[model samples]
Target: MALRLEIFDLQLFIHIVEVSSLTQGASRSAISPAAASTRIKNMESTVGARLLNRTPQGVTLTSAGRSLLSHARQVIQQMDHLAFDMCDFRGGLRGQVKVLAHTTSLTEFLPQALSGFLAAHQDVEIELQEALSDDVIRAVSSNEVDIGVVSTPVTTGALWARPFGRNRLVVVLPSQSEFVQLPSITFADTLTAPYVGLSAESALNRFMARVATQLGGEYRPRVQVSTFEAMCRMVEANVGIGIAPISSVERYVKSMNIRYIGLADSWAIREHILVTQHLEALPVLVRNLAQHLADYAQTHLPGPVELSYGNP
Candidate 1:
């Protein structure tokens, strides 16, 4: 009789090979190192071959281990596909979509788009998190997240993508401030008047700092907050001015006692995109949601939004 390998055993082997650490691989699956070693030994004995060579540096995959690695990946992929198909058959539309998006997209356009999608597909659940443009690309490429909404002109690296929306940067100033009357403001001029900024870690804030550096100045914001709403509120209190997305602060201008002015700089305008591993390979529910977002953005997002596909 042929030796039968359990799914867990195969998974353990794959993890060990990928991490190059037996202890780490075991820990990942919540198995003891001793038990994992025993299982690997049994598997080797059953196969009548050495799968890995132990050394001081760590284990190296033998020829047999390399062969099994490819097979393991394919089998896992197929199993995932099977699971997705099974869930679809059991229900018309129900699955979880993990999504990562940049700060601007999260604060601005994605809420409405996702809300519409949720309304249409009541059974599906969305797990959304904020990430920078680069991290978003990396997450989607590694299959760590189901979908990603990222800033445009970024390299997506073999992932299928389409234009999701556009974001325009605006200066948020107190209603009674002198800058409120300016038609458009430049970065240098805005900084001179004192600024209330987002957290230092935010991509937009980093870009703003870079702009200041180019102008031979430093960004020393009077205050820095985590969210756009918070920044707007601070500006309204006359704490200082702020740079925020128009979509984020559009509804808050009158209520929050803040006025927004468009930035004259080119970086003020940004294009965001929807990215996935492959459109055709996506589960039905996930695909539908992605399509819905794309459609919503097409009709709702304002001008100068580039809704095109590009290679990473």
Candidate 2:
């Protein structure tokens, strides 16, 4: 009888090769190192050839192993895609969509969009995780998540990305503060004021830093918070002013005693983006969700927001 090679065995072998260590590969696959080694040994026996050579530095793929790596990866990717397609058939739009979003999108924009999506497609489910913009991209690129919504431009590489919408970065101040009367504020106006800064690693923070640099002054934020909500809380308590996406402020407008002011001469716009792995064939459900988001943005999001950013 011909030897039957299991998908699990091929996946284990490929993980071992890519990680260059049975231990690391096992960790990634959530299996014990011994179990991973046994799987590889079984695979070699089935194939009638030694697949890897273990050395002091680490494991190196043998000629046969090197030859099989590409085919193994292709098989694994196809299997995953197949699973997604099968789920789509069974659940329709109700299947799970694992999304990684930035703080602003999670707190401000996605709630309404998700509500509308779920109302229309009662079967679709969404799982959300919040992270910095850069990490959101990484999650989607590695296929750890299905989609990412972030407030930064997506660059070319291993993922396909498009602009989902545009938001402005507005300055938030105490509603009763003396600065409330100003028609517009400049970066220089914020220099001497005690300000709350968003996390330095966030996309919004980088934009604020650039604005300060352009004004030939330093941004001396008295407090730094990780989320837009926290920044608003601080500003409400009279800790300091803050800058965040306008959408975030709108969500908290009624409850929070804060006012949002647009900055004059500041071209700081937050571009919400959707990112996914570059695939020759995308699952029907995933493609449908992407188009839904694009259509929603066109009707709801204000202004002439470009589709892919470059198309602008």
Candidate 3:
């Protein structure tokens, strides 16, 4: 007779791989190290293979462990949804939606849209995090996040994606700056000048850094700040010119002494998209959040793009 895999074992495996330490993972899962070791051994026995390679430093996933991680995560997510649904049947709509988004979407688009969704679904919670467009897509594909918003073009291989909105990257300069006379400028041209930049960890900064590298240049800022608003303020003080999404620049141009121009690069026009693994397969709470994002885009986005929820 074949032995069966258990949910507890799968969860423990995930915790262990994530922390790279069996002891720490067991502590997080509220189990003793001895019991955790027993469960792991049982799991290996059931599969007829070793999952982890333990060392003096920490544990590393074997090839089988790497393959199992994706499946384990999907199973765990489904089980969690099942538990949440049972609670919902006993009371009201209750569950959390995990979301990953690029910096522009998080800064300009999601706040109002998410606020509206949360207001309507009082019991639903959201866990939002900032990631680059590529990272956002990876998280959605891996089931690490329920929803993802990105500005890059996505191929429909294993994930479903729909356009939600559009934003343009613009160059902001001090009013007295020499470059202010140009109608539009390439992003690479700005790389040669002193720059006011967002923090190094920001998704936008990372994206720009990659672009600069492709153009055989570096994006070293004269000074770095936390927010787009602060970057514009630095430009206003003639600290340095900056580049940011038009949605963010529009809010500050009226009050700040900064001039913004379109970026000549075709990549400057960003088409925002929402990505998910399978809309129909996801929990109702997750589907509702996707619908709310679509509705928000239809109503608020500037362009004449018509988007419907059924595409998901």
- Highest lDDT against the true fold, candidate: 3
Best-to-worst lDDT order? 3, 1, 2
Error of 3 at 167 (Å): 0.4
Cα-based RMSD of the predictions, in order?
6.8, 7.0, 5.1
lDDT of each: 0.80, 0.73, 0.85
Candidate 1's displacement at residue 173, Å, is 1.2
Q: Candidate 3 on 101-178: residue-level lDDT in tens?
A: 998899888998898888877888899999998888888888888999998554546777767788888888898888
Off by over 4 Å in 2: 1-6, 9-30, 38-77, 88-94, 119-123, 131-144, 156-163, 175-182, 186-193, 197-227, 251-255, 264-267, 277-280, 304-312
Give the RMSD in angstroms, all C-alphas superposed, for model 3.
5.1
Error of 1 at 72 (Å): 8.1
**What is the alpha-carbon lDDT of model 3 when measured against the actual structure?**
0.85
What is the TM-score of candidate 2?
Answer: 0.66
How close is every model to the real structure, measured as TM-score? 0.73, 0.66, 0.93
Pull out the clashing pairs in model 1.
156-312, 157-312
The list of candidate 3 runs beyond 4 A from truth reads 1-3, 304-312
- Clashes in candidate 2: how many? 3
Q: How much is 270 displaced in model 3, in angstroms?
A: 0.4
Top candidate, metric TM-score: 3
